[model samples]
Target: MAAAIKLASDRGVSAIELVFARNLFSLPVVATWLTLAPGWRAVRTRRPLAHLSRAGLGLGSMTLNFIALAMLPLADATTIGFSAPLFATILSALVLREKVGRHRWLAVAIGLAGVAVAMRPGGASLPAAGLAIALAGALGTGAVNITLRQIGRTEGVAATVFWFTVISLAVSGLGLPFFAGSHDWQLWALLVLIGVSGGCVQICNTASLRLAPVAVVVPFDYLQLLWAMLFGWVLWATVPGPATLAGGGLIVASGLYTVWRERQLHRSHLPATPTEL
Candidate 1:
């Protein structure tokens, strides 16, 4: 998903074009599920404010992410963006006052170290602008994840996604005047493909989490890096250096450890017989 977004941006496509394309592509599947899924009527929520807030966060994260993609290699962009989960863990402890253990904090430190390695200073000649944008995107995405956790308790995933699409479309549309321009057929197809693939990825992600434990599934999310690398090399011919590879490994390890700790915490809080939806 990140690769596709960056590819479109590299081709000089606007963020609005990318966002609208994703929405249009995912519309069919979203519409079908919303219409035919059992208990679809029960998914509506009364928390309009929460929905709007989440949607705004989503828009900010995605927009910043697109900008980062345009400036950074796909693998680098994705690795930096992956820091969101670590940020979420730290923020949860600070803002929500959740109890965080030393082990988790250590994991966060290691993850940040990895990010630093990947984003070397003037010595290694890394793109500071790209790293900065990726960091901003990660922070925004972390906030969105925290907000989603709060809202998820009262709203179904479908309802959350629905509001996200609506709000993101509306907000991104307003920015059209700034970046909007003409596009060729190829650009149009790629933009639309981004939108459709993003929606499908979200659905798959939700289902994957429901079907398997986070400890089991979160590691696979790293596969996105492989995809990003492949796309970056094959399409853009951007190969990562030694520092990037090492830093990405550290990030993945720390991220996986953090996820494992989170799952342990969640299981500790829940009852023996988990409640079914």
Candidate 2:
């Protein structure tokens, strides 16, 4: 995903334009998914409003995170974005009314401390706008995770994934009047790569939630830091400093602990369609 973003930005695509391109080109892939899953019938929903809400939250998360990536070093941006899981823990308790024990509560506090460390108050080097925007994106992502868990109960992964891309396309289309421009065949090919990969990522994410609870699966997100660090280094010759390393470690620890506890409570099954959901 970061690689696509890097290519898009290199092709002189604005953040919103990339978001637009992602959804626009993604239409074909998602349409294929819908047809294979049985066309319009797969997307028939009892909760249009819920799907709309998810789309809004998702749009917000993607836009902000992309902007942050453009603004900050990739490693730093990814580390800060890790706060989403902590936010998910709190939202799960408050919104979903899921029980959160003292262990998770303590973990949240520690995660915030990690964020603070990564931010390094009064740090002249990092862009404050990037940090703030990334944190806000993470919060929205947390809400989106909780929302997915709620809707995933009755919604098929195909339906949930399809509606989001459709709605996002509509909302982001409004920006085309401002961002309208031309791209070469190379850029068009990159857009196709971005679109198809983005669709598969969305499918896997939605499917994971259908198979496991939020706390059980979100820990896997920490792997983004590894990807970010690798992309940053191999592409830009960048390496994260001590603060990013320490803070990222703390956030990973918190998420790993949550996954461990959740697994102890519930053994997850990974069938294509979960009978339980």
Candidate 2 per-residue lDDT, tens place, 1-277, comes to 7676776676678888878878988888888877876677888899999999999999999999878877888899899998988888899899889888887787788887888888878764998888999999999888899989999999988789989999999999898889867888887787778778888788888889878767667878999999999989988899999899989988888888877777655564444356666
Q: Residue 30 deviation, candidate 1, in Å? A: 1.7
Badly placed stretches (over 4 Å) of model 1 are: 38-40, 204-220, 259-277
Clashes per prediction?
Answer: 1, 0
* Cα RMSD (angstroms) for every candidate in the order listed: 4.6, 4.9
Poorest stretch of ten by lDDT in candidate 1:
209-218
TM-score of 2: 0.90
Q: For residues 1-277, could you state the per-residue lDDT of candidate 1 as single tens digits?
A: 6766776787788766677667667766676667777346744789999999888878878878888888888888888877776777777677657676897788879888888888875676657887899999988977776676677667777887777776777777777788777888887777777877788776665555445433344445666777888988998888988888888899889867867777787788886774642
Q: Which structure among the candidates has the greatest TM-score?
A: 2
| Best of the candidates, lDDT | 2
